[model samples]
Target chain A: MFNDFINQFWPSTVDGLAFGSIYALIALGYTMVYGVLRLINFAHSEVFMIGTFGAMFVPFVLGINSALTGLALVGVIVLMILAGMLASAGTAVALERIAYRPLRRRGASRLAALISAIGASIFLQELFALIVIPNVFDRPQQGRIQMALPQIMERTDLFSIAGHPVKLHQVVVVVAAVGMMIVLDRLVNGTKIGRGIRATAQNPEAAVLMGVNIDSVVRMTFLIGGGMAGVAGALYLIAYENTNYYIGFLFGIKAFTAAVLGGIGNLRGALVGGVTLGLVENYGAIFFGSDWKHVISFTILVLVLMFRPTGILGESLQQARA
Target chain B: MALALGLAACGNGGSETTPADGGSNAAAPGTVKIGFMGDLTGANAGIVIPPRNGAKLAIDQYNKTNPAVKIELVEYDSQADPSKAVALAQQAIKTDKIVGLVGPAFSGESAQVGPVLEEAKLPSISASATNVKLAENGWKYWHRVLPNDGVQGPGIADFIAGGAAAKNVFVIDDKSEYGKPLADAVRAQLATKGVKVTNDSLDPAESDFSSVANKVAAAKPDAIFFGGYYAAGGNLLKQLRDKNVDAKFLSGDGSLDKGLIEGAGADNAEGALIGCPCYIATPDVTDAKVKGFADAYKAAYNADPAIYASEGFDAATVFIEAVKAGKTTPEDINQFISTVDIAGVSKQVKFAPNGEVEAKDIYIYQVKGGAITLLGKAAEAKLG
Candidate 1:
């Protein structure tokens, strides 16, 4: 009985991790931004969408063919990734400048800041609807040669170990996300700017008094978070093989939930929360059937918040450094 | 923006009194306009856009051959949204001056637009709408060039029961109007074959499905039939395999897309079976006209033409034939269409009293290395 259950259960757990990777990637953006600015980047999903749109656009507009050498292919992909990152990061910065900057200047409360994030999200979604593929005659041919980076990020095969099939993409997503979190942890604990950002997040007044340029720190936070969302968007397109104007709504909400579940305003908490949430949702669906997957995930979220508002990792922003 | 496009097509008709279908016979003073409603942009556009392009090719060719018959094609993007579909139907009938309409490719949109077209007394022929109740509504002007899910689901179930000799089948639906009805149809037919049926429902929006996979694997069915589009079907197929479910994966037309193979991973989708309601790929007929049409469609769309394109061409051909048969007026056209029979790209086109096509051929296919290979074919003798 145990062997049979292990045979069935282990593979599902692995698949769950694969999906968790994508959630973790997007959650990183939510956590990092919240870690520094204490504001949820509601427009982060749009950033992901733009990244996918950009990924598809490169090979199409540039007229790249499938016969290119490996080096040439890498060059084109690197260029596409850079362009997508720049576009997403620029939009994130601009959104902060236009939507959140004014509110911040007015000394908006957390509630007002949250509202501004909501407003920005709506605006960007509408912009996509009217100006992007939804209204356009044809979707921008989203790059030449679909599934361009198959070797690095393909969906996992069915049951590799013990002849059990598994999705490759789900596993890659989880590992990449966890790997990214570890790198982020190292950067935060090891780097000088990490100390400054930590100080700013802990107490902005003290950081300002200590001569930290809070504006630059905030800008860097948006850039890194926005960059992560862009990467997530690109990865999502590879995983799903289709991109649409409204692809960001569910993912954004889930990532936010993950951030909250891990304890909002804590970076490591976000990573842990995202993977755990993804695993829980996957396991819940497997047991109850997929119809109840979201209900199960959200119910866990509500119960967790009610039981321990500080989240699984109870360390607040101030306590993290202390 | 959609309204302007409609008026622009009609305003180009040159005269308000002459019918667009008049062809060169009377130099047709008005546009013989056929309106289309579909998701020009959005998730389903990949399917809808190619058919529209094929229709355009047919229209261009039809106009060239029959100079007297100048049919105007106007389109509105419903975006696969039901409310938008309703609004578009109203505009197509009231403002576009369309005598006939084709499309709103999805089953859900067609359900919403059915009554509106019926009230307008405008005959609408769809190339891809497949719900069974769509034709059962007693809408006088409604017709479908493509087969309904009733024919498709049972046809596939017959293939599974007869060909695979399967006794236990698990049916799953994404819980949408399209998925649920199709699954029910397959389930009903499978039960008739003395096959045991286990049913499951899924939410299309959710990305994960480990728990469901565990349960499905535990059920230990011989096969699984998914009644949803590729989006969720791909993930479900992958996770089912992860849970070590060795059952043969089966689904209707919704699961048939290149994206499914890629998204589900070729490894997971291997040995999977799918069926589409139309089989235009058969070489049973060697008509030069069909080959020419196929070549033109491939050249224009950069994708292999499917039964939907053939159905779209047939819809256009039927309209032209109606015009030539002294159906210049809307009433005459309606009368003419009810009795007309013409060789379409799919088969000889003839509609029953309720506007359902009388004959259909469903094609069963299997995915091997991310390629759809024809497995078998099933045909219907008649529709009730």
Candidate 2:
């Protein structure tokens, strides 16, 4: 088993990173929301689900049944990503304005907010599962069928490690993820809006006293975070080539685990935790069999919590200024 | 003596009028109740609803024509839960007093409800539950319309070993109650044939299967057999194909839907082999009765019948035959169903001593031209 793990290390790492990148992207939403609102956005996973539908609708509506190449491919992929971002960001804002805002105005407890978040999550999942699939999409007969996305990019062998070739899509997913992370990192650290977000995370009351609009800051946080999850959704479609209503269920749990593991409010920590979780699951599956994959992920989460409650990178989003 | 006789008569009248007053109003004179129970609104509802519709269709047709001994079809939704199934089974036997039962749809539920129905001596014929251990329970009242998973696992495995002649096979399951046992049966059969079989499993709830897909690629097996339903099976197939694994892909009846094609994308799913014990009535079947049933089902449901629809119809037909033979009580129905021998829409309906169907044929299906097409029985299909 050890020798087999050694032989398949490179391919597993590549696979792990691609998935880890997605987890990291999603973790951003959870960490960002928790940082600002002090409420875990359990419904953020559904936001990703909505983005996947948005990305899928691009090819379906465009009548692009066949694969595109060259500049056209890049243009369409950009459009798809933009659609995803718009949909997710819009959803996050609406969820705040419609669901969370009312409760916050009524001075509801955090437990109430958590329940509302979970309720919203189920409502969205079922809305897609029952109403959306049979009523709007193709194949009305199979209500729970996973809708296949049209091939956006032609996956060709880019390179091989240890005689196992890597597909172009795998490389694209990792590159796109890193690029998004860099863009997010630069935006949060280099801009005035970034400072405003960091200031709020440090102390919402103090930032308000310093004349920062806490409401706008929270909205912006959700927007930026939801947008990241949206791109992850698009990349997930490219990687998996399938979409369903409940696709977000397990993914939501994993991303939340990633966020907590990386230090709940830290941007860089989410990335590290996601990639680490992904790599550990792959390696653990290889060494101990795939059944232990979940056990391994949760074990890492528990160990991190027990030993270092503040997480691997040690600080929340406040550390950006520190 | 006259007062005692009056009291006994009043007691009998009081017992009969309660059920007469409260529902079961249809139980007038010569009518009796039959049951159809399964998951009508849960995850396996997709699997159960087809059979439920088929059984309903059969009884509707029977009631319309026969008119002598009227049969009212009662439905109880178990949602594929075993505890619920046991409870529903009790209600069907004691409250509704149904003479025969069509299903508890899934294997786990069937196992739970089997003894309940047996204890009541209510004749039952499951339309879809294909667990082989179900037949080993020694329940005289419990029977199934189709072949067991034991027949299905070895039927495709036999083809894989002889027809495909694959030396190395990779067996995978979603670790579901349905998939795991079917996969085990396939692996066991392949082992007996001296085939090198690699085994693995995937979490059914998670769509991502890249890690497992990579393992399949590295193993470099001659073919890959996955024992799971279509949704997860399709994603795995899509992933394996994306990596250009190129090995032959085969799955059991659980993956025999066109949803498999939609999930894997038609291009990736092409040449995939699927097996099912249920038979569909194609356009070429010359049997007027088969075509009539198909036409009737389509007209009634306004959709093409899916897997196990015919078997459900067959199970209902068995009970209808007993009712037509003037068997009204559960004991009489049980005795009548034991000798049941007729041509069903799915296949020949004949029961062995152990309550499994005698005519058990596993049909081979292939994905060709972006559609699932029947390639005849698995024993004969040279998919290699």
Candidate 3:
């Protein structure tokens, strides 16, 4: 088992980091929503899923079939990222207005909000599977089958790290994800809107007392969080080269686990948790075979929660602001 | 709440109208209703659609030739779900009063729906459900045109271990109802043939196979046999090639399609082999009946018949012949099918005591220049 781990160390680590970046981006959404509303926001997965379709739509609209190189390729990538972010942010806002807002106005319990989110998730999934994809997209034949994403860039090795070839796509995914995380971190810590978000999350009653406009802050949080998930969705499609209606469910669950592992409400903790979970699962597959990968991931989650309920980074919203 | 109520009302309306429509169709004289069940819009759609089309073509030809007995085909898309297949079977039996059924298409769905059809005494023929255990179920009404995995698995193992001359073989499966049993049978055959075999299983839902690819690289097997559908199979093949493992890749009928080439990329998929029980309608096929069906299929569907198209055509032809002999009731059709022997497009159609095809044969195909080329029968290939 150790021998297997030793042989596969570098390649597995590279793969783990590439996938870990995606988890971190999605984990931010779960963490942010939980920080403010203390609601699980199960529908956030659908937000990420819609972003994938949005990204695909951009390429379809551009009439791009073959690979585009150089500046043109860069332009398409940027356009897809923007489209994905806009679509997902729009979806998140609409979900809040339609589902959560009505329930919130009636002073509904957190459990009610959670159930509503679950219903929204299921509704969005079936909507895509049954109606939108078949009727609107005119792809009645590709129902439930994962549609292949056009390969915009060739998967050429950039350089060798310890005899393991690192591909260009992997580098792009990690750099883009880390850059987005940094920008988000600065936004939450630096801007006035960021301060309002932090205030609302800390204490909604006190934030309303301080004229923070808690509702706007909450909506903004959702928008920002959803935008990150959108970016993750685009990156995921580029890396895996496929998209489907059901992609969000597994990814969302994994990202949710990452958020909890890093301390559910902490921003930095989500990043830490995501990367660590990715690396652990990959290494565990090496030691225990690939079939046990999910088992090892969930076992680590159970063990972490049992030992240190607060998680590795610990839930510290105020400390994060400092 | 209004939306929910409206949806409920729509559902009620649909159920009410279905039986009424079915009742009228059943009451129509000189009309023989044939039920076809398959995955039209799910994971197995790639494999199921061609067979479904073939069945449709056969029924169209039969109706044109024998105008007195108008055969009406009622298709139900089970979407590869067993529960949906069972429901479709019930609807065919209780509502449509179908004289025969063409398929439950997938193995898992067939296994679940088989007993139901058996209980109803409805004669059914499947084009692609090739699980060996399906035949062992002792369902008097259920029959399959394609040879089971028991015949194909050993043939595949023989090709890999002898024809390709790979001493060390690695067997992988998606752990599906179809894939696992086929992989197990192939592994057993390979071991019996004095070949070293390593067994591995993958979840079909997983998109990445880099971990498994690395494991394969470490094992250093000379040949890899995958028992799964095209999606996972193609991804695994690509990942394995990326790691520079120059092993001969082999798979079953599940991975036999243009989809595999598209998924694995043309370069990586070159020279891979797929063993299928279905007949490859090569230009060399001299059977006049097979030629006629192929010509009709090409004209009808605007493409060459795929792997199971001939089998599907043959299955429908068998049922049509039985219906023409004045077998109107379910039991009459079942009784006619049990002892009937007819020459089909693929082979001589005759069922053994266990509801399996009497004469089993496997065809080996190679991916050459981005197309599947028939490399003759598996038995003709020299075995070590």
Candidate 4:
């Protein structure tokens, strides 16, 4: 096992980081929402899911027959990411308004909100499975089967580390993930809206006393988080090259685990936690066997929760979360 | 409250619709119901749907003869889950009162459904469940239509060593009951054949194979055997080719669907070999009985017959034979099913005392020019 790990360490690390990048991006959504409202935002996963479908719909509908190159390729990638963001961020805000706001106004229990989020997640997945894919996408034959996108971006190998040749998509996934996280960090710590967000997260009642509109801050929180998840979703479609209704659930679970591992409400915690989990899973797959991948990562989660209880970074969306 | 209620009601996967051919033909002296059970909608539904349609076609053809008792082929969609299979098996035994059963198509469901069918003394002939231990259950009423993993594994192992002439082979399973057991069989056989084999597992539902693909690249085997369904196998194969592993890829009947090619794009899937006890009817199949069944199936469902369709057809024939012998109740039909010897589309339909089908050829198929083309039996096919 050690020999196998030693031989393939670089390849495994690179692969793990790329995977971690996806988990990290999605984890931001879960973490940001939890930081403000103390809500786990189970529906955030569905928001990410919708983004993936939104990303490629235009290209699929208009029939992108020609191969894109240079500026055209960059433009297409931007358009895909923007489309995904619009769909996901819109869904997140709408979800807050339609599903969650009503419950909040009613002064419903936190359990009620959690249940609603869980319910909405299933509803979104099944809606795509039973109705949307068949009727809207015009694929009536096998609604549950994956809709694989045509390979638009050419994925040539740029270089090799050890024996593992790094492909274009893998590089895009890691670089885009890191770049997005930095932008997010700057956004949350730099602007007036960022100050308002930190103030509300630190003390909701005091922030309200300081003349911050709690409702607007919450909405902004979801919009930013959902947008980040949307970018992740688009990146996911680029990396995996396919989308299915059931894709979100597994990714959601891992991202949530990442959130918890990093300290549920802390933004930076989600990044480190996600990358750590991804690395652990990859190394575990190599050392123990691919069969024990989940067991090893999940056991690590249990150990973290048992000992630290708060998480690796400890909980705080205000200061240390960045 | 409404959200919780909605969640509670969403466990079942697909809406159950009785075939139009089944319902209106019960004008004979007696009406007997036989259940066709498997996943009609789910991830693996592509492989199951053809067999369901084929079974319906057989029952419809029998109903055309205007016999004393009309046969109703009721469908029990288990969605390929074992717990669901157990519940559906009970529903078939209790509410539907099906005299005979044609399936619990996957291996996991068959394991769960076995004791229930045995307890009820309801005779069942599965068209596609090929776990070898299913036969070890001592279930008197259970019968199979194809060769189990015990035969398929060694046959594939022999082909890898003798036909393809590979010394180093990498074996991967999806880690389901169906995949793991078959993979273990292949690994055990490869050992006897003096081949160096490395083992690993992946879950198809997870939809990421980059980590596993990387490991495969590092290990660098000459040939790769994946014991799983087409979706994961194809995706994994695609990633392997992307990483330029270029190992000779082979999988069992589980990965034999056209969906695999769709998953791994045709260029990458080219030359990927598959071993199966189930025979699909392509245009090149000159056998009259197979050709006729394919045409009849196309006319019935407007679709081509795929893997296990004929096995489903043959399983339904045994139940039809039970009806022909004036066996209407479950006990009489269960007893009658064991005695029937009939020539069916795939082969002569007969069961040994252990309820295993007669040993048949495990055909080797190669993905060529984006089409799954037959390459005769495992013994004859050159893996080269």
The sequence of per-residue lDDT tens digits that candidate 2 reaches over residues A191-218 is: 9888899999889889999999988998
DockQ of each: 0.29, 0.29, 0.50, 0.56
Candidate number with greatest TM-score: 4
Q: Quote each prediction's TM-score.
A: 0.81, 0.90, 0.93, 0.94
- Candidate 4, residue B130: Cα displacement in angstroms equals 0.5
User: Across residues A124-172, which tens digit of lDDT does each residue of candidate 4 receive?
Assistant: 9998888888787787746687877666777688798865688888898
Cα misplacement distance, residue B297 of candidate 1 (Å): 4.0
lDDT of 1 by residue, B220-329 (tens): 89989999877678778876775568898988887776657765777778888888876554333368767777787777657677536777778777777787665766
**Against the unseen true structure, what C-alpha lDDT does each candidate score?**
0.71, 0.83, 0.83, 0.84
Single out the weakest 10-residue window by summed lDDT for candidate 4 chain A. Answer: A58-67
Candidate 1 lDDT, A1-322, residue by residue in tens: 4444565566557656666667777787788788777787788888776776676566556764333445674576466566666767777788778877788889988788887788888777767655564333253431111222222333336346555565655554555566666767777667877788788888899999999998888877777677667767655654554555666788888888888898887877877787788788866665566687789889999999999998888575555762
| Order of candidate numbers by DockQ, starting with the best | 4, 3, 2, 1
Model 2 spans > 4 angstroms off: A138-143, B1-35, B39-49, B69-99, B112-122, B138-140, B287-292, B295-305, B328-331
Ranking by TM-score: 4, 3, 2, 1
Tens digits of per-residue lDDT for model 3, A112-146: 99999999999999888777776656776565666
Per-residue lDDT tens digits of candidate 4, residues B1-384? 322221222223222334433223242348788888887767788888878877878888998898878887777767787887787777667665778899989999999999999999999999999999999988999999898999998888888887888899999999888889888888999999899999889977777787788778878999999999887888899888888899999999998888888788778899999999888887667889889998998887777788898889988988888888888887888787777778888878778878888857798999999888888788888854
* Number of the top-ranking candidate, with lDDT as the measure: 4
Model 1 docking category = acceptable
lDDT of 3 by residue, B1-384 (tens): 322322222232222212224333344688878877787667557787788878878888787785677787767778788987887778778776888999988899999999999898888999899999998887888999989998899999888877889999888888899998889989999999899987677777777677787778778999999998887887788778766777999999988877777677777799999999988675556778777877888877687778788888888988898888988787888888888899888889998767788878899988889888788688776422
Q: Considering DockQ, which of the candidate structures 1 and 3 is the better prediction for this target?
A: 3
State the number of backbone clashes in model 4: 0
Candidate 4: C-alpha RMSD after superposition? 3.3
Worst lDDT run of 10 residues, candidate 1 chain A, spans A142-151
| Docking model 2 quality class | acceptable
